[model samples]
Target: MAALKILGKSSSINVRKVLWTCAEIGLDFDLTEFGSGTPNSVTTPEFLILNPNAMVPVIQYEGQVLWESNTICRYLAARHQRTDLLPQDPMARAQVEKWMDWQATELNNAWRYAFMALVRHSPAHRDTAAIEHSVREWNRHMSIADLQLQRTGAYLVGDQFTLADIVLGLSLNRWRASPIAHANLPALQTYFDLLCKRSGYTQYGANGIA
Candidate 1:
């Protein structure tokens, strides 16, 4: 298989999502660092041509350019026919996509403020009230994940691991690595432990970049 040309820094969670997916699929890729302060920064005109949004993860495959981390992951899985990662059944696919979308929209939104403030130390995100609110919402959303894990007793969408776990697992990694207090979630912890057994998870998802 031809190696994919990926534009992103490995430290980026978004980029790591693609890396983990590729590892799981045994797909080969060459990554160019397009993060802030790098020589090939995302702000550069050349980088913007590939991804107008200036996002870190833009994939070039067979003359096609694709952005959005979750979309890239799904596309790779579908392209490789990895039904174990992304099922063909409509309902199962929808279930996996639902959580992937939640991770991108709801879960990401909930954690951004606190994560920026506490982890990135972004001056713009230092408001104490905002950080507290963000932490509360983040934990609440994770509790919902815990409930789902309790129901499945394994992966997000039942016993089978899917794309949902890839996205959510990284989010969970970020949450754990952050200094914030986590809710009492035994099932979620078990799920994390299970994911740890996967080489792809250890390689990309849990590489301590939180």
Candidate 2:
């Protein structure tokens, strides 16, 4: 191994998705604490030059500098022939990307509400009304996910795990840990539990710092 570096803290769900992707590809990594003003990505001038946003996850493998959680998973998974997790056929890959877009556009916003309400805000300080609104949004989004899963095989897109699963699976961590109630959605619960069973996801995504 020629020393692969991952710039992000384990407490981040976005970063955790990349971590799980790396683990899925059997790639070893050296993750450093960055972002959230921990002298991570934000402090380093070179990293800032690469990612102006100073996001948590910025991976350096060999000579490639990769940012964004979903893209990182794509690059990492494709490298190790884990196309089952990413798919090889162009159309299949596109379908996988569609689900990834669904995750980014729809699921990401819902997860942020859960994160802010449950992790960032204390229980007493939490606004019940806001929480309900957030929960309703999340519930609607998750219901769509459950219905999607019910229509598909087991994972998000295809018969096997893909970048979509890793991306959305990480989000499910926050959904389960938060006070959101899971009712009559056995399919989604099963998928969530399955993601937890993976050692990488269990170790990284289980407890998000924010």
Candidate 3:
């Protein structure tokens, strides 16, 4: 099969999600970075033809075009039958998918305002009150993840490292790199350290890009 073509900048957290997943699955793919620190190439007419939403991390796999970072990761795992990263059992898969969804929706949404204000410094996100609220919310969501890690005593789902870790790990990296003040989360800290041991995390995740 041909190498998957990924469209997105390496500095993007979402794009890094796909890159880290490919590393975990040992999948060979080519990346076309578009929108790193300048005007987004996603809005270009040619790029829009690939993804109508004009988002990065779109993948061209075989003859199919796919978008959504987490979904793209799931597709790559399933395609390679990497059940180790994504289990095949119905219940096991659901367990993994649950955390993946949480990271994409709950966790990701909680950090947007704070990340935009403190990190991206977006003019539109200058509401100090809203930024503080978002920071608190982001920490709260991360605390939930910490509790889960405590329960599992290992990865998010259990002893096995699944797709859940891939998405959540990237989010954790962002949370750590963000300038927002965070509550003490020892479990989360240890989890981040553990993820760092993976070459994939070192290369695509913990590359000081935040």
Candidate 4:
């Protein structure tokens, strides 16, 4: 099989979702740097012709070009679904897509603030008020995820790991230690612990690279 090409940096959670999706599907990919507020090789004319945004995670697969993290993940799953990252039934797949959209519209909206404060800015230059605000909002959003997990089980799609779990897992990657209080949520903590066990996450999680 031809190896997939993903344009993006490893530090990006968005990129990592596609990378992780490839891993879960028993596929390998080549990633080019494109994010982290730094210019990347994908900005070249040849690359720009493929993805105008020149964003990391614009993937080339099956002779086609695709962008946006969740969309890329879905494409991968739909293309090679034998591994079960995506469901076989249409209803189940729709449910997964809904969670993926939530990851984009809801999770990213709340988490980016905390991520900027804790990961992007220097501790000395960090804004206490902004960080506090983000923490509250993130915690509140996390509660929603927590409730979902409690109502279901170990996985977001209910039992087995699916693309929904893979993508939502990426959006919440930073919450485990982002100065947020999650002491009351055992299910959420379990999900984090489970993700840490994956080889891709272990290699990436280690070194604080993401």
Candidate 5:
């Protein structure tokens, strides 16, 4: 089989999610950087052909083009039949997918403005009030994750680590790195500490990219 070709930069959290997933599955892949502070290849005609959204983390696997970070992780896990990473049972799969979706949608959306303003320091996102509001919301969403971790007392779904942890782990790193006040969510803190022990998190997540 041809090695998977991942098009994204190492500094990208979304791209790192895919990279960490590959590490967990012990799959080899080739990565091409197309992230911030580079010659914007994502907008180029050739790259745009692979992903209409022109996003980083677009992948070419088994002659099929795939985009969206979470979706790419799901495809790779399922394709390899890595039931440990992505469960085969329907309800178990849904449990993993639920947190993945939350990370992609609600959690991600909650932090955008604040992240751009405080982390990226983008001038266009300098609205003080909006940044404060975004920070509060971001913390609130993370609290939900903290509660879930408390309930599971291990990985997001249960004892075994799954795709949910792969996604949420990156989000947790982002929250920690972001320049916002955080609540005393001990469960989340414990969860983050647990994730840090993994080789994938050491290489791709805790590398101080965020």
Candidate 6:
């Protein structure tokens, strides 16, 4: 099979999600930097042809073009038959996917404002009130994850580290990197330590790009 063709900048958390998944699956890929700082990227006609949304982290494999970071991660895991990352059992898969979706939706929404303000240093995101609100919301949603970690006493879904952990771990890295004050969540701290032991997390996640 042809190696997967990934289109995105390496610094992107979403791109790192796919890279880490490939590492776990032992899949080879050729990545082209095509977003943010890359000249004539995302907005270029060629890139828009690949992803109409003009987002980073687009992948091409076996004549199939895929976007959406979490979806790409799921597809790669399923395609490679890495059942440990993405289970075959419907209920078990749902358990993993629910947390992934929560990370992409609820957690992402909570942190976007503050992240753009503090990390990206966006002029439009400089509203002090909005940043504080986003930080509070981000911490609150993370507290939910901390509670789940307390329950499972291991990975997000259970003892096995699934695709849920890949996404959430990156988010946790971002939370730690952001300039906002953090809540005292010992469970989350422990969870971060546990994920750090994984090679994938160390290479792509904890590599300090967060």
Best by lDDT: 6
Q: Compose the digit string of candidate 2's lDDT tens values, residues 1-210.
A: 477788887777888888888787788889888877576547567878768887868888888787888888888878778878888999999989998888888877765655676767756537777777777778788888899888884888756777888777766666776766754677888887777777877777665532
Better of 2 and 4 by TM-score: 2
Candidates 4 and 5 compared: the better one by TM-score is: 5
Whichever of 3 and 4 has more lDDT, that candidate is 3
Backbone collisions counted per model: 0, 3, 0, 2, 0, 0
**Model 6 vs. true fold: TM:** 0.98
Off by over 4 Å in 4: 36-43, 122-128, 180-183, 204-207
Poorest 10 consecutive residues by lDDT, candidate 2? 201-210
Worst ten-residue run, lDDT, model 5? Answer: 32-41
Pick by TM-score: 1 or 5, better one? 1
Q: How are the candidates ranked when ordered by TM-score, highest leading?
A: 6, 1, 5, 3, 2, 4
Candidate 3 vs 4: which has more TM-score: 3
TM-score of 4: 0.85
lDDT per residue for candidate 3 within 22-124, as digits (tens), equals: 9998888888777746555788898899898888889998999999998999999999999999989999999999999999899889999999999989999
lDDT of 6 at 126: 87
CA RMSD of all predictions: 0.8, 2.8, 1.3, 2.9, 1.0, 0.8
lDDT of 4 by residue, 23-77 (tens): 7777877876775555667668977888788776788877888888888888888
What is the Cα root-mean-square deviation between model 4 and the actual structure? Answer: 2.9
Give the clashing pairs for model 4. Answer: 7-57, 8-56
Q: What is the lDDT of residue 65 in candidate 2?
A: 84
Candidate 1 clash pair list: none
**Model 6 residue-pair collision total:** 0
TM-score per candidate, in order? Answer: 0.98, 0.87, 0.96, 0.85, 0.97, 0.98
Two-way lDDT contest, 5 vs 6, winner: 6
